[model samples]
Target: MQGFSGRFKDLVRRLGVTLFGIFELLGLPRVPEKKDGEGRGKG
Candidate 1:
């Protein structure tokens, strides 16, 4: 039904936002051109 689909969409949107926040908290770097870049930098 229409209401069910709307609820599902909202749920998905909230989930996406929550996951993005968790990723941010975890310091996940976005994709880079090179495979071993950014997060894997030498200390």
Candidate 2:
């Protein structure tokens, strides 16, 4: 039998892929990651 952790991981991976597909269908752009001290009052 398969392990519970393996099943959980598969579920999470599938969910992430589905969400990404929806985003692509809607033509949404991914948010850019924040750089080091970029928004930490370090101008």
TM-score of each: 0.60, 0.62
The runs of at least 3 residues in candidate 1 whose Cα sits more than 4 Å from the true structure, single-residue gaps closed, are: 30-43
Give model 2's TM-score versus the native structure: 0.62
lDDT by residue (tens digit), candidate 1, 1-43: 5598899999999999999999999878875476655467676
TM-score of 1: 0.60
User: Compared with the true structure, what per-residue lDDT tens digits does model 2 show for residues 1-43?
Assistant: 6699999999999999999999999878967889986777645
- Identify the candidate with maximal TM-score: 2
Clashing pairs in 1: none
Best model per lDDT: 2
Model 2 poorest ten-residue lDDT run: 34-43
| Model 2 misplaced stretches (Cα beyond 4 Å) | 30-43
lDDT of 2 at 23: 94
Would you list the C-alpha lDDT of every candidate in the order shown?
A: 0.85, 0.89
